[model samples]
Structure formats: C-alpha cells, structure tokens
Target: MYTDQLKRKLIIKKPIQRIVSLVPSQTELLIDLGLEEKVVGITKFCIHPYYLKQNKKIVGGTKNIKINVIKKLNPDIILCNKEENTEEIVAECEKIAPVHVSDIYTLDDCLELIHQYGNLFNCRTEADKITQKINFKLNDFKTFIHNMPKKKVAYFIWRNPWMVAGNNNFINHLLTLNNFDNIYNSKSRYPEIELKKIRLEGDPDFVLLSSEPYPFKEEHAFEIGRFTHHAKTIFVDGEMFSWYGSRLLKAFDYFKKLHNRII
Candidate 1:
C-alpha cells in the first residue's frame, strides 16, 4: 500500500480486475496501459479509444459522476484526478473501492502518474513504453524550442463568460514548452476576464482557443478577434494542450506545426 496524490494509502493486495475511471485523460491512459478488459466503467467524456463508450458503462460526466451506478458496478479500483473529480465523489467511490487520486501539474507529474498506473495495474512494460515515448518527444520538442523565440500567448478554455488558462496548470506547461509565454502567467488557474479590454498594450501575440469544455470554433475565434485586433486567433486541439495521458505522444508534432505558424 502506497500514498496517492491525496496521500491516501490504496490497498490493492490482489490483482485489480474491475476498474472505474472517473477522468477522461486517465481513461485514455487505462487503454494505453492495456487495461481495456479491466476498465468496466468510464465517464461519457472518455471518448478516446472511441469504441470505449459503446462497450463500457459510462457512469457520468467528469464533474457529475452517477454514484449509484458506480456502487452497482462494484469496482475493485477507481481512478480519479484531483482537478477533474471532487472530494465528495472520491469519498463515495472509496466506499465502493480503493480510489487512487492523481494531482497533475506538470509533464513530469503526468509521466509519474503513468508510472504509478503501471504499478497499480501490473502493466509495467506497456506503461514504460508510453512514458519513454513521451520523454523522447519532450526532449525532441525541447531541442526545437531551444531555437525558438518566446511568444506571448493567451489560451482560452471557455467562452461566454470568457475564461483563460493561467499559471501553474498543465495547459500552461505545454504553452511554456512551446515557448509560447502565457500572458496570464500573473494569474493562477483559469480566470474570468474581460475580452473587450484586449488592447495592444501587453496583449498576447496569439489567442489560442481550445476545442473542449467550451468547444471554441473557427467562428468563435473570429468573434473574439473583433475585440482583440492585437492578437492572431487560432483554434487548437484541446486534448494536445490539456490531456496529460497517452494523447501526449502526439502533442509534440502538433506543437511543432503550431510553432512554425507563428512569425
């Protein structure tokens, strides 16, 4: 038994057979970890491995998990995240099985989680392959990044009320890796701000709109452009920027393409 991100010791004396993953990113990881048969439940948002939803029982969305459905599932282990799941849900899940919570803030944290998942699921070789791939890509991206100039950027995850990814988060970490300096680095986490006030003064060089949580479209970027003429708006894959799982294996290529787009 060892401590998870929440410092809760998870007792998995026997092999983990049935698992309920509460996070989409982690759900994708379970697939990468070769635990497809073991994963009996996942959220509706666990759309990666696309057939997963059709085959597995979806407990609910990330923010709102169906507790009764989870209890009925009688999972031996529940995979969750500190940011994606609530404490109350964790408690309820613990009642059914050992809930291992992950707190991911950086690329290292993501790799570490993958490592831990390997230990948890008895898939060490596969997990090592995944992390190795991620590390190789990270280093390759770093080499490319070393030659690039730092670009000021504003990454938006939501619309309507207008919220942007700030400091000390996974999205910001990717932004940093790309040498895309976050203009909102002064702020922590996602912050609601007035898009109408986007002036030329200290404004971002680019306004990146994510395709998840809010699903910002090409039209949305154009709409935001009217308010901020200083920044060139672009629609980016939400998964590449936010997903801290096996999806990261493809992020560096996307990042390289994105980096080439900027002057």
Candidate 2:
C-alpha cells in the first residue's frame, strides 16, 4: 500500500512495469527516476524528452485524454496532478488503474513527490539523489537572492479576461521563494481580473507574463507594461515557475538570472 500526495491509498501488488504520465513535469520526473523503459504512455504535451513523441504512445493531451489510447496502453500506474488534470478524467482513469494524484504548492511537496515516486517505482536511491540536488540548488538560490529587495509582482498566466498566478498556488510559492511577493496575494487561485484594475489597486514592482497556459509573448509583456508604469514587465519561463519535478534542477539557476535582470 502506498499513500499519494493526496493521501489516497494506492494498492500495488507488483513492481510498476508500465507508467502513463498525464502531466508534463511528472513525465520528465519518471524519466529522471530512471523509469524511462517503463514509461509506456505519455500525453502529447509530454515533450520534455523530445524523443518521447517518436517513442511512446500518445495517450492524448492533458485536458483531453483519449480513453481508447490509454486503454490500449494498459498502464500500471497513472501519474497526475490536481491542477493539471480534471476530476472526470481522473475518475475515468481510476476504473483502469490506480491514479496517484499530486496536489503541490510548495518545495517540500515537490521533494516528497520525488520520494513518493521512488517508493512507487522502487528507486529510493535515485529519488534521494534528485532530492539532494533540488535542495542544493534551492539553497544556492536563497544565497543568491540574499540582501535583494522584495518586489511585488503581478504574474499573468492568461489574457482576454486576464488571469494571474494568485495566492496559495505553486507559482506564488515559487515567487515567494525567489523574494517576489505576489500582488494578487489577497485573491484566490488563478483569479481573472483586468491588469488595469490590479494596477489601480497597487502598481506592482514587476509584471511577469508567463510563457504557458496562455503562451504570453514579448508583445504581451509590453501591453501589460502600459498599465503598470511603476513595474518592469518581462516574459518569464512558465516551466521554471510551475514545473514541480526534475526541471527544478535548473529553476534555481534561472531564478538567479531572473533576479539579476530584475535588479
């Protein structure tokens, strides 16, 4: 018996021989766990390994999983995230195999997920090593940001009815870790509001346009900058801020550069 991040018990009678990763970050994580051979199915968005598109069975996109494709693969365990995956999809996948749902909002949770994967896949040693590396880089980032001024930021994830990386989410947690205070801290998860409204309430010190979920480009940053005259607007890599897996090995370094650019 194994308990996932969601505290749901997973019954594993045998070694995990086939893994179907529904989340992009966890797909990279499974590979980092040295379970590459066991990764039989991945979503179309699981493009980290690049070769995955050519090698593995594409079960479908994160939001629109192909049931027939998934059934064909017959995964032993399906890795999912609470935010990235929907309840209906999870319920459907549950009928086939045990689904490990991860609800992540902090660095500790990420480290625990690595350990959980270790336990699930019988790779405790590799998990420990990856944990250490993530921690080491985390510490380095802390040191790098030491004595830096805390800056209020408006992190945009979408446009139209503009949405922000709000409080109590992984993006906000990572922002705080890097000393970027979310201006939308009072709001709930991914609140949709006008950039002009946010600027009127309190002009952020920085306005970040994320390169995901909406794929904000350099032009979007300039557009947001118009409303936030007091802020420095720039395009940020969404993966570094949102990815809760092995890609974190590179996040701290990216943060260092980001902070330097901000300063």
Candidate 3:
C-alpha cells in the first residue's frame, strides 16, 4: 500500500517501471531522480530535458489530458499537481491507474514532494541528492539575501486580461523567499486587475514580467512601465521562480543574480 500527498491509497507494483507525469516540474524531477526510462507519458508542456517530447508519449496537457493516449502507455502510476491539474483530471486518471496529487506552496512542501517521490519510485538516493543540493543552495541564498533591502513587486504572470501572482501560491512563496513583497498579496490566487488601478495601490518598486504562462516579452515591460512609471519593469525567468523540484538546485543562484540586478 502506498499513500500520495493527497492521502489517497494506491497499490503499486514493485520495481515500478512505467510512469505518467502530468506536471512539468515533476516530469523534470522524475528524470533527475533517475526515472527517465520509467516515464512513459508526459504532458505537451513537459518541455524540460528538451528531448523529452521526442521520446515520451504526449498526453495532451495539464488541464486537457488525452485519456486514450495515457491508456496506450499503460503506466504503473500517474502524477499530478493540485494547481496545475484539475479534479476532473484526477477522477479520470483514477479510472486508469493510481493518481498521486501534490499540493506545493512553501519550500517545505517541495521537499516533502521530493521525499514522497523518493519513497514512491524507489529512488531514495537520487532524491536525497537533489534535495540536499536544493537545501544547500537555499541556505546560501538566505545568507546572500539577508543584507539586501526588501522591495515591493507586482509579479505579472499573464497579460490581455492581466493576471498577477497573488497570495497562497508557489510564485508568491518564492517572491517572499526572495524578500520581494508582492503588492497583490491580499488577492486570492491569480487575480485579474485593471492596469489603471495599479497606480492607486501605490506604484510598486518593481514590475516583474514572467517568461512563462504568458511569455511576457521586452515590449510587455515597456507597456507595463507606462502604467507604473515609478516602478522598474524587469523580465524574470518564470521557471526559476515557479518550478519546484530538482530545479530548486539552480533557483537559488538565479535569485542571487536577480537580486543583484535589481540592486
């Protein structure tokens, strides 16, 4: 008997050889944990390790899964995330195989997810190595950021309707870790707001445009800069801030560079 982050029970076979990963971060983590060969299915968004799309079965996307494709893969287990995937997806996956859903917010939650994957995939050593590297970088980042002045930021994830990273999410958690106070922290999840209203809240110190989710380009920075002329509009790597897994091993270093750039 195996338990998932959602406390769901699953009967997994020993020497687990087949896997279906719904989350991009976890897909990358699975590969880093030395389960590359075991991954039989991956979402179209699972672009990490670049060549993954070439070898693995494409299972549609995080929200819209191709059930027929997953069935063909015949994976031993399926992995999903609370934020990236939906309840409907979980229910659908349950019909085919056991589903493990992970809900991550803080760094602790990320560590727990890695530890859980370690236990589930029988890759405790590789998992531990990844976690240790992340922790080491985390500690180093803490020291690096200790002397830096905290800046209030508006971290934008999307445009058009214009959604910004809000409270209780991984991006906001990472912002907090980087000592960047999120101006929209009071809002729930990803909140859509009017551009004109940004000035009313008192222009933030920075307007960070994320690379993913919306693919905010240099032009978007200039557009956002027009709204909050006082704020410095900068483009940030969404993966470094948003990805929770072995990716954290590289995130701390990115944070240091980001902080220095801002300073």
Candidate 4:
C-alpha cells in the first residue's frame, strides 16, 4: 500500500549541494571547479583566491576543526587531505556528513585527485579542460627549464626545527621540474637537519624560505644568509609550491616571474 507509514525511505543521488573543505588546496580546487556557490564553509588556512576570506565561513584549521561550527554549516560533503588533516577530525566530520580524503605527493597524484574530484562534483568536462591546460603549461615549463643548468636548492618549510622539503614532497617534484636539484634528496619527506650540516656540506645555490609553517621573514633570510655565501635566499609562497590543485594554474606564471628574478 502507498500509505505514508508503509513507505520506505528514499535515497538522494544528486551531486553534493553544500561542501566544507578542510584543506586549503582542496578549497582552492573547489573554487576553481566553479563550486563557489556550493562551498559554504572552509578552514581558516584556506586563504588562497583571497575572496574566500570575505565570503566563506571559517570552520577551523586542517589539524583542528570546529565540529560544532561545521555541524551548523550542514555540509553535504566535507573535503580533506591525509597529510594536512588529522584522522580524528575526519572521523568527526564523517559523523556530520560524507567525507572525501585526498592524498597527494607527486604530480601524478595531483592529476589523479583532480580526476577524482571531477567525477565527484559532476564537473568532468571542466576538470578535463583544466587538466589539459595544466599539463600543457607544465610541459612548456619543463622544456624551458630543461636546457638551463640545474641549480642546487634547499627549500625550508620551518625555521626553529630546521625542517626542509625532501624527495617525496610535491615541492621537490616542482623543483626537479624547474631544473633545481634538491640537496635533501637523501632524506624522505620533510626532515629536520642541523644548520651546521647545511653550512658544512649543503652548499645550495638557492635557499627558498616558505611563508607558512614557520612564516620566515626577511630578517630570518639575513640569518640564514650568513651560512650560505653562494645561495640567494628568498621568501617564497608556500601555497604556490605545496598546493596541488587549481592554484597550480596560477603557479606557472609565478614561477616564471621567480625565474626571471633569479636568472
């Protein structure tokens, strides 16, 4: 019988209408995928695109999410990352809504994540166009940097702890793509090394201090500058190097500007 008491619950198969992104990279990706109206909440760390600051509600950071605030947002989908977000936060968010986690380390991982997001958002066409554009730009950058002499570069992610990006990181891949050889390839992922060791044998051609994780300032550069005589130390945007999403579309031009300034 079609009585309300005998009716079964229906499942909705529509695309997610409201999304809350825990990771900054995924937030930027969602925005790039034309999901601005769909995204209702974002982490405080999701500062890229600049306008997110004005429009999006802060649900907390990647490591620490405001679960109560998130519940209030009533997001249908919550996007996060394995490296950037903690398991507890993911589990808590799962209680509120379905959560999709992305793990990205290399260029291939980035492309795969893009494809997955495309499928998830029902925006496969736009995703394919973006992927093609990114691939073309990356290929062009590779060709341009291929002939140039490889420079030894040390990318710093933290200051007091003295942590630097290692071979398994996206920044390392980007550096290799840009014809810059990472001095910390021996170590895996972000490793803590002594400044004395860096002074003794690191001998990097360039020292890139990231703006996040430690917020390296110009004065800090002057401090590290003493150790590296041949290396030119500059404060670089952490997002440009680490974000593996649509932010990458804008990274090539930034890289070109950086290359021109350095070379």
Q: Give the TM-scores of the predictions, in the order they appear.
A: 0.96, 0.97, 0.97, 0.91
Off by over 4 Å in 2: none
Clashing pairs in 3: none
For candidate 3, what is the total of clashing residue pairs?
Answer: 0
lDDT of 1 by residue, 1-263 (tens): 85687677998877889999999999988888888999999999999988999999999988899999999888999988999998888888888899999999998899889888888888899999999999999898898889778888889988889999999889998888888888888889998978877654347889999888898888888878887756888888999999998989999999888878776
Model 4 lDDT, residue 153, Cα: 89
Clash count list over all predictions: 0, 0, 0, 0
After superposing candidate 1, which stretches have Cα over 4 Å from the reference? Answer: none
Better candidate by TM-score, 2 or 4: 2
Candidates 1 and 3 compared: the better one by lDDT is 3
Model 3 scores worst on lDDT over the 10 consecutive residues at 6-15
lDDT per residue for candidate 2 within 141-186, as digits (tens), equals 7888888888988888999989998898999999998888888898
Candidate No. with top lDDT: 3
Off by over 4 Å in 3: none
lDDT tens per residue, model 4, 1-263: 11111122222255589999998988888888888999999988888788787898998888988899999998887887778888798789879877777777777788887887787778998889889989988888877676788888899998787899998878898888788888998899999988767756568989999887788888888877788867899788887899897878888888888888888
For model 4, the stretches where C-alpha displacement exceeds 4 angstroms are: 1-14
RMSD of each: 1.3, 1.1, 1.0, 6.4
Number of colliding residue pairs in model 1? 0
